[model samples]
Target: MSLELYYWDGLQGRGEFVRLALEEARADYVEVVRGKSSEGLGTAAMMALMKSRDEPYPPFAPPFLKDGDLVIAQTANILFYLSPRLNLAPSVESLRYVANGLQLTIADMVTEAHDTHHPLASGLNYEDQKDAAKLRAHDFIDHRIPKFMSYFERVLKQNPAGDTFMVGDALSYVDLSMFQLIDGLLYAFPRALKRFGEHYPRLAALHDAVLVRPNIAAYLESGRRIEHNEACVFRHYPELDKAAT
Candidate 1:
């Protein structure tokens, strides 16, 4: 049976990470909440499932995958589970651990990216948190970006198999996640990313390479690829951008 991915109907959000892996692997799966519904199963449906008693393995949030009798949540954890099955992970135990470590790093960067606009509180509107957002955005541009980029660049440069992929010679889930990270950063912080790109040539190349992958290219061209917006994690507020500059 095909796997069932449950998440908000629109926007990539966290779900896109899992979706990208599935697409890259050419795995058969259905985007559950995105399917036809009278009321439309979006965030509400996702929330209900998380809180439902019927669910033996409730997710902490959206972007959970149900494969047969198993349910898995947490973006990195989902990737951890799917990576081996999809042959998008290293075979060696140490390399697999390294891949997951990189994934966690990506998660940290993503959270920081979201905080750039919602530093005060995610519940508050960007308009309401503009001052805090400015502070956070500046910090991110000045410190966080370089820090994360340096780490990933080191991983690539220090990899035993060379700089082609995150974990050794072959493409892995971490590479795809890194691709998404760079792509989202570029969208959310064009100027900052441009400046940051000069320091991490290999990372930029990986981002470009992932986009050229057949499945990823199709996903990008298709309506499935949601554009970054104010409602999502990586919001582009002019004030935040200006602060970064």
Candidate 2:
């Protein structure tokens, strides 16, 4: 089975969630935008592909996966499609639904995370929207982060399978996504993250475990991992982050 993933060539952004799942499962796939020989056909090329009317199942955004004739979009949707096939989801229908629901919740939290830095406008420069960002960041750090963390902590605690994963005894795509969200928040807001870290030990441990997974470890060390920068969703302006506390 030939699989192709198209997204911005540099930063991980939302695409990294899908990438992490594929990597963790050792799935065979090609990162189209990161192809070395065709340097010019990078992120821009991927965007063009999304907009092309000639392509069937044209994706509305990046991070879409192509496997033969099937095309899937949206990070949660992509994971929902891949999870069962890759053994990254529970077998029972109810368990799978809960896992997908958890993934969707993570997607909402990610959107909120992105908005903390770009509250007013995603296209505008951080400097232009610093004040708005500060307000948003404060709300996220003080309320949203803790609220979401508590909810996830409850899910972990209540799971009949125990504290190992979001859904069942085995790891699921939701687990990887939770790890990504935690890592992003840590990178983008270390000070605020520290304040909330002790409140969610299970979530913290999950993040650590996912990082050490063989494929994830290699991905982090191979220079394929992009540094958090202003261009991406999670920007770290000192003032906004500071104001969060």
Candidate 3:
């Protein structure tokens, strides 16, 4: 059966991470909400499923996955569930947990990235929270970016197998997520990421490697890959970006 991925239409948002894995694995899946409304696979259908009382446990938001009879929510949880099935996870059981931990950490960074533009509140517009966002973005670019990215650099450098992949000897979902994370960061803060190659060489290399992977390259060139926009989690605001020292 084709996996049904439920996420908002237009923007990549948190759903892109899941989409990356699915694309990399060449998994048979359908973007439920992206489908035509005429076919009853649009946002209305997605909302109906969410509101359906027949479901034992409904997701709090979109970016959930429906695999066979199982409904999986939360980006991290969705990736964890799909990774093994997609052959994008480590064969070692213990390393799978490690990959999950890394993915969760990546999620944390993603939240921080979103908060940088909407520091005061998600309810408020970025223009309304511009002042606070500037402050938050400064701290994030100066401290958090280095902290989280440095840890990933260390993870790659210290990988038991090699620096090619995140959790194991081969490509894993964590590596795919890392690529998206770095790519998003670069889009949102090009100035801040200017020194990425110098400071986070391993991570930068990994990002480059993932970019050239045949499946990923094709997906990127295809119209299916949504461009980063203000509505997405990683928004580019010139005033909110600062170059690293």
Indicate which candidate wins on TM-score: 3
Residue 41, candidate 1: alpha-carbon lDDT: 53
Provide the global lDDT of candidate 1 against the true structure: 0.85
Q: Give one digit per residue, the lDDT tens place, for model 2 in 1-245.
A: 65888788668799889988888888888888877646644666777778887988788888898878788888899889888888898988888889888999999999998998888887888779888888889889888988999999889988899997888898888999899988888888888887555788888888888989998898878776787776666767777665233
lDDT of 3 by residue, 1-245 (tens): 89999999899899999999999999999999989989989999999989998888989898999988889999999998888889998999999899999999999999999999998889988899899999999999999999999999999999999998998899999999999999999999999999999999999999999999999999999999999998999999989898986
The candidates, ranked best first by lDDT, are 3, 1, 2
Task: Give lDDT tens digits, candidate 1, residues 118-215.
Answer: 88887888889888889889899988888889989998999889998999899999999999888888878877776655789999889989999999
**Cα lDDT, all candidates:** 0.85, 0.83, 0.94
Worst 10 residues of 3 by lDDT: 236-245
- In candidate 2, stretches whose alpha carbon ends up further than 4 angstroms from where it belongs are 36-41, 243-245
What does the lDDT read for residue 222 in candidate 2? Answer: 74
Residue 194 deviation, candidate 1, in Å? 1.7
